[model samples]
Target: MSSAQSSMQLSNVSDPLRVHVPPNETPEERKRRIAAEKKAKKISEAIDKQLKAERDEMEKTRGTKLLLLGSSESGKTTVLKQLKIIHGKGLENEREQYRHIVHLNVLTAIKALAKGFEVNNLTLENSENDEHLAAILSLSSIKESLNRQSLSLQAAVGGLKSADDATAILLANYESVKAVWSDSAVQKYFESANDIGLQDSAKYFLDNVDRLAQENYLPTDEDILQARIRTLGVTEHKFDINSTTYKIYDVGGHRSQRQYWAPYFDDVNAIIFMAAVSAFDQPLEEDLRINRMRDSLDLFNTICNHPLFKNTSIILFLNKIDILKKKLNRLQLKTYFKEYQGANDFQSVTKFFRREFLSRNKVVDKNVYVHFTHATDTTQMRVIVASVNDMIQRENLKASGLI
Candidate 1:
């Protein structure tokens, strides 16, 4: 026996599970023992090799990862949803699920619009008297009426065919409702939407109530684009471009959910930070006192200076530019942000914010790509997203010395 083997045996002599290798005289026994040891060593080496190969392959195929980051309701999830609609494979089957969300979205928008007018003390006036809008949107009455209609619709259809049966009743008096929305007083009150959580697509959904109420209604691209669902946790999606696989990670922007973002920071190729342009006049739903834009700016600063993301490329998406365009004409940017000394037009607001974002970026030797986006504009999004993908790919290639 070799000295090492003898020492091993001696050390394990007192152990109950120790294997006994006898110092026998027979050459046949020695030969069989060596063969057994050789076979076991070869098997272990093969297993180690196979495990190493698998780890290597996993590292290689994880490919380039992109992360979506923003403050709550800043449209990060909307951008991710857009990516899924645009680049996802086999997503046609997911349309039915999104249809229900669209129905719910329209319902939610109506409730918000009514609430906006109500909370701001705005009234819809007829020649008779000053009619408080809240009286029309009273939750107790609407809930009871909606329940009755939804039950009836479900019973006749043998199931809940449409998500919102209340849409029909809401549509019946649509013209009057629209007139209230068009009122200058109500539009002025809409600037305080931070407290109201008003949807920008309120008019669009209210106008399309008839089409949306149809039993066989399939969601249109516009419907899907305008729909909003608060993301609760991180969701990952994968797709291929030019035969190169890419993984995109989306995380919730709510303060409670931000704790879960650290795990996804490693190996990210680019960070798409979305800030809602229209939110300049709004307040955060979570904290009524905090301005939504200020919250977004703080989050942006944190991400730009984060040690884990030091090498990562940053892309800025100033979303909801369409809403900003309309709001800019009526609501002065200086009303909310006193620092703004320029004209209250779309161009001025966008340019100022663009410069604002650029100045906030602290990353050295990196240019932050800024895009003015309207999340619901799919045609424009298709072009913007393609440009974004190309930028990310080029950055990745350059990093890997492949350019």
Candidate 2:
């Protein structure tokens, strides 16, 4: 007998008491109910197991890992520092440490312009136009001046408790340096910005030497932004955004340091590639024959087409737009890149450059996000950084099937 039939009992006392079947459930209906319950329980167990697996994976991987990649001086380090300013720790104290670099930048900018004279074949007095070759080797003092300043700045940064006294002396020495730089023979080279290009910020610092030479002077965000320092190795910065931790890696961009980049390429979630847009007219410091813009494009192409990063996200930062805007009226883009057909204005030129870079992307179906950035501007960086945070989080969540 079925359980339902077994449960039913006849009441003997009530004159032919009826056998009651509770709710009249049949054998087939009971079998179906049991089967349905078992199926539901199995599905529940499977879902719980999947959720547990995902949680474990999430716990192990932590949050998104963002990688910064580009050729040297593409502003990768600056972008990483921006991440520090927005989402990092101990940056306030760290800012003081960068003071020496600022002094060094001013010195390097001056030296770069002075060095241009040699590259352009300009010599000091006593070299006639047609008579004979000038004593080109006598220009050793230009390099010597740079070395002396570098040594002095290093000494000050190491020994002095305050940067003001040493900076004051450096500025005082600048008067004599400016006299040498302003000489008519050297002024001719500055007109065309040929050979080694001088930084636009060089004049800004020179103009305000009196104010900046003070011992109490601290580098502003703009000063730090314009300061150029080549990163040497991999630097990792940590930050938490939207309930997820982010590990951002900034690597050296120099040619020699590129071999170190491959190890970090694996397990990376996204890459923020920086290209110095203003470098269209300038050459790479490592190899003066190769245009900086060309190097940036080549590096971008390699990163986009890499098999390891096929699924990784790419964000292109067209850096130094502020300098580009300033130089448009002064320097012609076509003079450097003969193939550029766009107008001389900022919008047209930037668009042309952007297309030139984007055309090199070999990866299909992957959209590369581009941002025109002035790395020194903290205000603009804050907005851009927040946008990047959102994009990374959304992409990561989708990849993990949490969206």
Candidate 3:
């Protein structure tokens, strides 16, 4: 057989299987098939249009989402609480919730003062306080024990009333706390409380020891605002302003808790980045070697230049200005921030830190609104929050091309 004749034979064998045969359809059947396809197409189009309308409605009704980002003890939670008091319902009903926390604050402050005394090699002025010091230190040891065994600070403190003897210990030794807190040497240590990592509220609580120790004492609004508790995870609060709902998220600022932050980056309209200007002389509780102000600056730089937040409006809150002002009167900013050459006065120091934070923004077009805030002052925060809300609304409108 020739090669051409063999190829022809192979084609004949494969052609039958390769060819596709359509079944014959009547005219009526053809009409029904086309009509069915058109009906399906109409349904799909209607579904798509309905979905688009739903999405538009949702976008119209959605509220502004703001993230409060800051280092631990930078007053983020205080800001949140102020907002709750100003916009949402007042903290009147919630005052009782913080009674134990107020007690804990006193305990924590005294323990820090005691530790400061030990670290500074200073003795209590009153030798009689030696017994009281022992009692206070015993409470400190109990706190440490509860912290180690409990999964969270809330759990540990919550157990203070029932699951543990910390409350009794605290009550029994609160008078001791008062005694140690009043010691001349302890007061000297408290002068550098920032250096010793004492909370900003320590002075307030320690000052009101007698009032707080009253049998039925409830935390006042100021006490609740000043109470320092380390935020463990993410907290959300919602309030309405000018018919627009606003959701504020307060996330833990510790390094360990930072992992929970990225999940909230998406769809965030604004970020309120708080830096404790007073923390210039202090160290981070998480890493004692790193200065708290330096850590805040580094974190601010990262967030300002982050790809995810390139377009997100940023509000820089130089919080704890009151503390910073007091500290500057005694401690020089240049001592901690070596690059600082300005005077130790409040104006010069604040201007320098503001410049430092603004200089970190790599995006030339991005504007960071800076505010010097005292988070505990409700009157001041009321004004700041109003301005912030206006700025956010304007920014959102601009983003949507409505401006």
Give the best candidate by lDDT: 3
Candidate 1 collision pairs: 194-283
RMSD of 2: 10.1
Candidate 2 lDDT = 0.69
Cα deviation in Å at residue 158, candidate 1? Answer: 21
All candidates' TM-scores?
0.72, 0.75, 0.82
Ranking by TM-score: 3, 2, 1
User: What's the TM for model 3?
Assistant: 0.82
- What does candidate 3's lDDT look like per residue over 11-116, in tens digits? 6674643533335977887778778878978999999999978965776577788899988878888888898899989888877657766766667667767765
How many backbone clashes can be found in candidate 2?
1
Clashes of 1: 1
RMSD of candidate 3 to the truth, in angstroms, is: 11.7
Candidate 1, which ten residues in sequence have the lowest lDDT sum?
A: 144-153
TM-score of 2: 0.75
Model 1, range 188-306, lDDT digits (tens) per residue?
A: 55555545555566567656766876767777666766656666688887776655567878888877889999999987889999998888887776677888888888889899888
* Candidate with maximal TM-score: 3
Question: Model-by-model lDDT, in order?
Answer: 0.70, 0.69, 0.80
Each prediction's RMSD over C-alphas, in Å, is 11.7, 10.1, 11.7
